[model samples]
Target: MYSPVQPMHIPDGFLSTLVSIVFWVISIVVLGYALKRVGKDLGERQMPLMGVLAAAIFAGQMLNFSVAGGTSGHLLGATLATILLGPWAAMIVMTSVASIQALIFQDGGLLALGANLFNMAVIGVMVSYFTYTSVQKLARGKAWGIFTGGALAAWTSIVIASLAAALQLALSGTSPANIAVPAMGGIHMIIGLGEGLITFGALAFLYATRRDLFHVGEAAPKGSKAIWVGGLAIAALLAVLSPLASTHPDGLEWVAGQKGFLEAARAPLYNLVPNYVFPGISNGSLATIVAGIIGVVLVFAVALGVAYLRRGRKRSK
Candidate 1:
């Protein structure tokens, strides 16, 4: 199942400042690698769509669906993005979403940013992309192949990401393998099922309406203005619906509760403000909504900035 922060449910004080800082560095390095992989082919035409995808993933993450026993998990959207934009680009987009969630919403820990990015961005996009591609080829591009590949990729990414997080927790001495691994893995398995279904459905819809969008070959049609518009509309819809998402604690919290490490979680260093609430935001729902709005703008800005920078570099050459 998908874990929090994988979809941005990182609570206060989940990791040490040192661990978090280290991850931040790792994230930067991975992001740089992703940019180089993306190269200059990311044209102006892709900027708007990239922004829309960022916002959509951010908002989609907010909508937590109920899992078994009232536990809930949200959509990861990584597989869908990778399927649409290629894995390398999806890494950039997902990292933007994760970074914005940390800086703006304070939803994820600053120190753990790199670990979160590694799990959600690196694994979700890159690893899942390859897995989905393999599955697609095995299925020979049938509808079921796309559906199954999307589902399995989403599911596997969550489990892998959870393992990564668990290892971090164990290494930090905050948790033991007995507690961290099995609990995180067990809950996420359930969560990943929901992730799989949502991915399958989204891919199915895209395939039905715009099959050309999924083509990952030289002969594929260039993305059109319509795709950008459609993507934005979807992002807007997800943003509007984010407030109605599940409020239940995610897999990590649930695991913490079950394993008795819930109280052991340390507070983050950046908790200068009470409850880490952004100024002028009282209700959690309002704060979350505002964060989602800010995330849309930030993601759009970052994507456009990266695109233009790359474009400029290309023109100079």
Candidate 2:
């Protein structure tokens, strides 16, 4: 039984055209604001940081850990990005990741991309930012406070994202609200624990080693070659480990399956690295690694390009 690498994203037919169009409008407005905000104060060092963060998130998404009841989940990375890059820049990075996943990897449906962007990039990132900030204020910025904030923020983001997706499915009449909400929301609660732990551990590591990275969003330090190199190295390492990711259905897929809407998923318009396997690669593990590495590079390039283009626009004004 060969399972496609479907993450927590809605496929094409799952969303009605009207619903999809509405989300597209909303996503466009929000992302346009994000671009404007980032452009206004984009720094030289921030370019590489954006690229590195995008690459890291892309690679991290490849390693899906299994949750209970035959479901799987991966790091949404919205909270991590928001904490490190601010909400605006984090939105850019997350949109890049989601776009690449849909257009290149075919992980999600093209028609449903707007909804995905809204769910993960906008709602998830915003929820994470506010939750973390509230916790940080309560703890007075202590190490324990930051770590707690990151964990809680990450968990809440995932749950909220799932709820948004569930609402979309219900509104589309793909699944009833009674079934969709509970099924989508319940399993994700367990899945969110994994996200929370990963986020907490990541924050703890950074707090121990590179406390200055936290300041990159406010006044980024001058570009450091070592940081970029180290960042890429970490992404590459995650790609190398992508082969070991669990093959179970993610929250969305599992809910779709249980609710009898899994068959509504449509094939992508095109295939670049379909299902995270490189072309002409017989070995499954090797092919996944190759595909993952390529995804990392592509995401890095896109993020850097966006950063530079925005900076250029700001200078021209």
Candidate number of the best lDDT: 2
RMSD of each: 17.2, 18.1
Worst 10 residues of 2 by lDDT: 240-249
Residue 188 miss distance in model 1 (angstroms): 0.6
Give lDDT for model 1. Answer: 0.68
| Candidate 1 Cα misplacement greater than 4 A, ranges | 1-12, 67-70, 216-317
* Reference-based TM-score of each model: 0.64, 0.66
TM-score of 1: 0.64
Each prediction's Cα lDDT score?
0.68, 0.74
lDDT for each residue of candidate 1 in 1-317, tens digit (9 for 90 to 100): 43354433344366655556666787678678667656665777787888898999888887877767777766878888888887667888998888888778776776677778876787566557656766877987677888898898888767666766765565455666556666776777778888898888888898889988877443322332332343334334322322222122243345444553433454443354565474558677988999999999999999999999999999999
Residue ranges of candidate 2 with Cα displaced over 4 Å: 1-7, 64-73, 216-317
Which residue window of length 10 is worst by lDDT in model 1?
240-249
Give Cα distance to truth, residue 95, candidate 1, Å: 0.8
